[model samples]
Target: MTANKGLVATAGTELDRLAELYGGALTYEAAVAGGIPIIRTINEGLAPDRIRRVSGILNGTSNYILTAIDQEGLSFDAALKEAQAKGFAEANPIKDVIGIDAAYKLIILTKLIFHRTLSLAQLAPTGIDHLSPRLFAAAKEWGLKIKLLASTWESRGQLNYQVAPVALNPSHPLYQVDGVTNAVVIDSDLVGTSTYLGPGAGGKATANSVLADLASLSRGEQLTGSSACLRIENGRPLTKQRYLVVNPTGLPTGLQFSDRHATSALTPALTPTDLQRLRATNPGLETLALGE
Candidate 1:
């Protein structure tokens, strides 16, 4: 449904159907409507104010591809083939590879966690299809595992979300996650961080979770959800962005290097606004982040 434009109608109808039987719907679709006490609400005796952030690696295809490329030293094409061979990827794999698939899951997630609705066009998702296998291979050498992350957080009562490849160091819980496995990290103000790790086996996992929700709903669990007057952003300036501008020789004035780039990596640092400013300031600076 997310691949098409009728998701809002589909989710609404499913949620209303669930509402007929369960006081609040508990399926993932219902959870997308913010009616269920799923992870967003089911904190273990912890209140809402105590929770700070929710981030997850939600796409199994992307995870599997990256795992093959990084751990198994397969090229992007080979890794993608492997993912398809293992039944982790679709025959037409653009949605999985381009991050649209992850964005839909994130859209469902942002609605559940923040009580706000968002569409694909607004998020303008960034894809990993532009990512260089060389960049990931280098990251692996440095003990950094890259994962496509669906992250959402609240600041000043406004909630924001994004899906992007994140370079995780050893200390990050997501660093150890690989293959088609998925993991979600809920960072709170009190209990610190709780991580949920699972197989993320596409429709199989969805069916399993749906069954679990039915079992929970059978118990007549009741939870109240809140809808607030909140706004959404494509999100912040992304705390960290790794880049390897192909043709730039000397440093751009006032630009401090974030990390030592390998001589051949092709990642770029130009956010749209930054690219505009750079061109206005230094034209012929031939580099841009893949999405932009």
Candidate 2:
């Protein structure tokens, strides 16, 4: 499971050991293709600058649920059930709903994007567990779309990473993304915003990708340098934070919910301390990151 820290670590360890045995070995899962070095190499091929920021919708289950809520007006429970029935979600769906799956993808992407390997613990991920369908309704009323996005970017010389529901205006490229399709948006100076969208489900996509990779390798094409070792720097810090708070509760003195009932806020970013305080006050409080 990508969401499980121990499991992800074990897989990474296996990848490490396997690469030692087989240099050109590749993992062709959609997650790996969408988040790892394959996409990184493509970005480099097209853009002059290396990847400075990477973000996207990494989980099909979560996207399916969000689409159901937004388009079908289904509650979280019903949407989750439908996703499970369609094989979009697992029987035990904790990882998909909670944003941990997306977070794990972000963690893996960070390894290549920032050249830093970060622990899941240090990431302080916030899941969609407590999210209410009302958030979607309110967002729709405001001409915005709600999507669970995982992002890694340089913020004030620090790499900020998180997986959370973020509101996007129609103008943004990701606003139209729906259903089980997956997308990754890379931002760099040369390329303003490069959006890649493809089916995140079905085995055929990954199978084809791996086959293509084998073809490339057989032709003696090496896209990236040796990734045998990682030089990790101090991981990024989440600072100067703000969140769209759901449910009226005791936020910090300076931080407050936008409206009592339903509304919006430009909203100051919450510090990690502020989130800890808010979470302590109300565990069920839901938050959406305002923007990049």
Candidate 3:
């Protein structure tokens, strides 16, 4: 019965233990994605399946800012101001902009689904303030959209996660999730893939989620702690991944690229080592991971 993700996520599952000890249920459906019922979906609907990955546009303020930059060609400051005017952002908006808001949500989900604890220090989230209209424009040249994506996945028996700005191709499920709207794509074994999309904020939206939790309480359901164990790993790509490199100075020497733009280029599938070497070879180059 908490909407404070910062407290719940950072508290290291103690709240869950206390609730179970007191024979009470702790429901936090509103803490993650507003009105999405994602927690219930995972705890009930998708409980039987094995989830491989969970990714989403979790922050309404950041999404609104990025969407404004992409659709209206607005500068970052201008877009953020517009979001505040539209009530999509807070007056300060520091947590939302710096990816801490989304990181908290991701940490909560990781605890519930993967039974792992992740600290913000371990997450090392990347904010969207570094992104510019030029990055969005470059992505558009390849039918892509830039989004502040929060993702968690299992790889080689280890849990890897990250929250950052990603270049999503059109075919991706989250590509069309724009503005203050939120969307979560869950990849599981039995059901394949399931997507949940809706308005991520507002009194009515969050109230609906709160009401759902109340209903579950009325049904006499008690909250329980995760009884499983999982290995947590830092944000690292185990497999090859494509990247969109934006360098106003042009491509780096000895780098092979295709779909070249004036200030950016699409890189082939590269390993983490290759990306590290490329960054060493060329300083100050913005590299965005291309999402599937």
Residue 241 in candidate 3 has what lDDT? Answer: 92
Per-candidate RMSD vs. true structure? 5.4, 4.6, 1.5
Which candidate wins on lDDT? 3
Candidate 2 stretches with Cα past 4 Å from truth are 1-10, 21-24, 27-29, 33-48, 223-243, 246-286
Task: Compute the lDDT of residue 274 as modeled in candidate 3.
Answer: 91
The global C-alpha lDDT for each of the candidates, from Candidate 1 onward, is: 0.62, 0.65, 0.87
Residue 48's lDDT in candidate 3: 76
lDDT of 3 by residue, 1-292 (tens): 8777898889847877787799876788899899898988888888778888899999999999988888898889999999999889999999999999999999998888888889999999999988866678788887889999999998878899999999998889999998899899999889999999998888999999999889999999854333245688768778999999887787765577766877788899999999889888887677899996
The lDDT of model 3 is 0.87
Q: Which candidate leads in TM-score?
A: 3
Q: For candidate 3, which ten residues in a row score worst on lDDT?
A: 221-230
Q: What clash count does candidate 2 reach?
A: 6
Clashes of each: 1, 6, 1
**By lDDT, highest first, what's the ranking?**
3, 2, 1
- Candidate 1 per-residue C-alpha lDDT over 29-92 given as tens digits, one digit per residue, 9 for 90 to 100: 2222122223434332444544556788877788888888887888889999988888888899
Residue 129 lDDT, candidate 3, scale 0-100: 86
Regions more than 4 Å wrong, model 3: 223-228
